[model samples]
Target: MRATSQDTAGGVRRTRNAAQTREALLQVASRRFARDGYASTTVREIADEAGVNVALISRYFASKEGLFEACLAAAVTDLRRDAGDTSLEAIAPSIARRMVGATSDGGRLPDTLLLLLRSSGDEHVDNVRREFLQSLSERMAAASPAGPETLLRAQILLATTLGMALLRTSMSIQPLAAATEQDLLGPVSDLVDALLAEKR
Candidate 1:
């Protein structure tokens, strides 16, 4: 038989419904994983927040580990271009300021990474950390030399960004929280310039 108009409309509706469901689940999962941390945030909670069944999450993402991996992938993809475009010196301070700013109201991406770091516990955050850092290093080392100092600068920059993110987002420290945009950029940029010099 031939395809009918109703059949085509029904297919379109199903596709839209699935997309909406996935998007809703991802939004809930991302926020909860960011706010509550990944290990503490359960599929049931995410499901409830999304107003869907627990099985729906599994159907969309397979497992909690899979979901975390997806978030990591997203974080990596989003930052890859930013990391690739600028010098380490510029990138470092930019990262510090952006991270601080991103966390002013509690950022989901940074929080998710922090949560993953914490949840790793005694198992070693090395592999995951390395994956994130390696991509960063490669991106920043584009026009520069690659060596211990360069790696160190990259690592420190990453650490600074993450540390600032934690301080602003997680701990909610006053001086940092109250810091002016320039207050953050001034010191961070100087440090990055120095670090980049060392890498040279």
Candidate 2:
């Protein structure tokens, strides 16, 4: 049978409400997971902050684990879109700037990285972290597909980028943190260039 007008209206309302709740939960959960970590943050806390029912956590995200994963996925998607290609030049100057709070939502980069780092002890988080690393490695490898040592090169390149992110934000290293975006971009771009340039 075709749906009635009331049925269609109700369905639309439900869809809109679900979308709003999911967005609210993500906005709160992202900050909480980043600040308090996965194990420490409760579903109730996320729900309360989002001004929704605690049950919404289960209804919308299934569980705290699911919500955590969703947060990671959303953040990664945003970064990939914002950063453009994973190219060394594309990453450091453009992406790196966004990571270091050079823009409004740019701070999410460090937040997500730190969240993953802090949550690494958990088995699920470990798997997710591995997947995240592997994806980046693949992209990096593809960028220099001619090399026999693509995997190693990718690992080194990522390590450099991750270290710079930590020092500039998480570790709160002043020289790097205080440096102007242009100055920081130069060194990072050069480092990435050298890494990409080497075959051995």
Candidate 3:
């Protein structure tokens, strides 16, 4: 009538395996979506790459759209974790340091940035991406010294980082792509001071 210790251990193992499967799907789906674009990637490809049942995608994410959204959320969460509780004054410099340090053996964009940059073609998914960027801008504005242009400044700061990531990683533009942290930190810090620092 009651479950034994062995049964309980089996349940725990099953739960752990489910979590692993879900993560595997997400990881493969993120890369596929980034490399192939959303419309071109298929549930079967993701499952095959992750070594999971195709039905698991529907079970875990409901649909490909849901999986894409989850991947975007994970990417944003990773960027936030890397940024930590950085102050407005430190935002640009912090981002620049990370950007310059980022490396990809194939010269591809980092999965996080690529996920955000790649288009999904679905209106709803595209809107979700824009909304994430807008919310990020709002958070940056809230952290900056209050002014009429605070939001505008925050958006510009966001644009600056996004552009740098695209050029340095995706485009592999010269000098910028090869730049070191020291090469970027001073300029980025100056930009932050001009954009967000309280006038004195």
The clash number for model 2 is 0
Candidate 2 Cα deviation (angstroms), residue 124 = 5.5
Per-residue CA lDDT of model 3 for 120-174, tens digit only, reads 6678778877887888788788888858899999899888888887777657799
lDDT for each residue of candidate 1 in 1-200, tens digit (9 for 90 to 100) = 21212223234322226666776776677666656776788888887887656776787788876665555555555555445357655664656555544432234445644544544232333366567677665556553454556766766766776777677667788897667667777777776666655443
- Where does candidate 2 stray beyond 4 Å? 1-16, 101-107, 118-125, 178-180
Residue 63, model 2: Cα distance from true site in angstroms: 1.8
List lDDT for all candidates, in order.
0.60, 0.68, 0.75
- Candidate 2, 1-200: lDDT as tens digits: 22222223234422236677788898788877776677788898888888766877897788887888888777666655665576644656764576556324434566755555556255775687778777876787776634677777777877776676667665678887677667777787776666665544
Cα TM-score per model: 0.71, 0.72, 0.71
Name the regions of candidate 1 deviating beyond 4 angstroms.
Answer: 1-16, 100-109, 112-129, 141-148, 178-180, 198-200
Q: Against the hidden true structure, what lDDT does model 2 obtain? A: 0.68
Identify the candidate with maximal lDDT: 3
What clash count goes with each model?
0, 0, 0
Spell out the clash pairs found in candidate 1.
Answer: none
**What's the true lDDT of residue 161 in model 2?**
66
